[model samples]
Target: MELSVVTGCLAGAISQDPEDVIQGGDVLNKQASASMEGFLQANAPPETEVLGGPCEESSWIRPPVDFLKCNWDASIDGRSKKMGMGLVFRDSSGGFRAAAISNIPYITDPEIAESIAARWVVSMCAKLGFQSVVFERDALVVVNSLLSPSPCWRICGGIVEDTRRMLHQFNSWTVKHARRSANQVAYFLAKHALSLVQDIVWRGECPSFL
Candidate 1:
């Protein structure tokens, strides 16, 4: 907000060498402000408006910040009859932001596990009141179907549709594919759920490593 004010003032200035003035101590903040606004304005369409919070120009950035990492995963083991899901949200710095887990009895395929994980992600974003969300999954089939969704994939159809509906409430959100190596934290969170002997519900902390 302060940036917006200064940027406008600098752009209207009556001074010669405004760039030089900007480089000097008195108006460096104004230059930085204009530059940042320029950055914000670059990505948004000119027609967008701000009803609250940030204007569309600056809204693409999600906080819990760029240093924050957000992703999810599920474990599907058809032969072993185990299914589990997890979400791990962290600041880019790798600190634990938030984590959740669920164990389901419908253990017939890895597809089911992945679908449930996607559903959980949308639900979590809504529950957290996140205005901007970015979800990552390692499963290409799942991510592709989500981006250009299919009406099939019936194994978790109801949950999939529910997640899609929840997604419409956000101002900005993205879902994409990530490889296993890039998705290790969420992968491990789901893996940890499979390691547990007891069924558990998501609670406040990072639940035990079991």
Candidate 2:
């Protein structure tokens, strides 16, 4: 499929306000929503911790042979109500395959921002024709929502559902949560995107800053 078609699908999926959009296929009861909300509140890592300074103890891990790992992160600016998303794709040997950074309007909620980032990365991977991929991100809530069999009912529910649908296009895929330290490349890329007026993409080359 064309990249424009993928992007158009994403735009339609998330165009409505969260309260106004509930996917028919992934609908959950209010009780389920309440229970899940509490769990998210209790277990989700703090924003600062997820976006904190680098750590020497944790590092990026390579995927299995024949697979690609995509590490993704998001940076949000409260004043601008915009979010920057970064995605770095690496091969099983840990060689950089591609990277991209994008800036877009965002909801104030961090979970929503991360959800949008996940959707964007998935769409990008689909556009790149990646069949076997592992997605890693620093937002535990967003990761959990993707991994859950039940539909997410948070404000980012629609975005999460969209991401999940896109993931089905892959032959093999998994979504995992990683430490900020393990996601440094994408983290910094997201920060770098905050200064840009347009998206940037690198293929078969590393960014100079890295």
Candidate 3:
């Protein structure tokens, strides 16, 4: 099913001509990993005030100067068997930079879906040549996996590996845990993605729903 779904997205790309818009694949992946490895590895943010987990800071936080913050979230519609992923990027001053929503029709596992969402936004930022980035997600599992230098061998291992590999492209990057409240925009965009037939990208400002 995964093969067929990927093949279909690939076939559809021929007409859409994604090549004229952005590039993809292992070459870019390797380049990103190599560049990222040249810098000191970053760790996840210190645990929030809540002690054992992320705090209920229901608000967005700005990244350091010269860095961009990209928040991502994922949702699954069990009835429709669709997974929606949303990403929003903002500059250090907290101004909206870009946002994207991708509807994936086959993902069922929540962890795997979150991993896919992380990879999607990371790849998007990489393609856009973003060097310093901070990725925030409500899924603590994903954040923890990214912080670990050792590879994981779970069902979602492949996606996790891809995500860690991509972090190498950034001169400096942070994978931190944010409460769902703080991730509202991306969460809404993710839920909205359930209705989209194809991926959507917005620049400078978010859609009216935001």
Q: What TM-score does structure 3 among the candidates reach?
A: 0.73
**Tens-place lDDT digits, model 3, residues 31-148:** 4234323311323333311112232345788878988888888877765666777688999888888777677766767777777777888888887677778788877777788777
Cα-based lDDT at residue 45, candidate 1: 34
lDDT of each: 0.50, 0.64, 0.65
TM-score of each: 0.58, 0.71, 0.73
Cα lDDT tens digits for candidate 2, 1-210: 000001111221122222132222222223323432442354231221122221222678888798898988887766656666778899998898888777776554666677777888988898778878888877676677777779788878998888777777777777777777798878766755554544556677564445
Q: Which ranges in model 3 have alpha carbons more than 4 Å from their true place?
A: 1-57
- Ranking of models by TM-score: 3, 2, 1
- Candidate achieving the largest TM-score: 3
Over the full model, what C-alpha lDDT does candidate 1 score relative to the true structure? Answer: 0.50
Which residue runs does candidate 2 get wrong by more than 4 Å? 1-57
- TM-score, predicted candidate 1 vs. hidden true structure: 0.58
- Candidate 1 per-residue C-alpha lDDT over 142-173 given as tens digits, one digit per residue, 9 for 90 to 100: 76656554565576777667666666676666
> Which pairs of residues clash in candidate 3, taking residues 3 or more apart in a chain or in different chains?
36-168
Q: After superposition, how far is residue 1 of candidate 1 from its true place, in Å?
A: 46
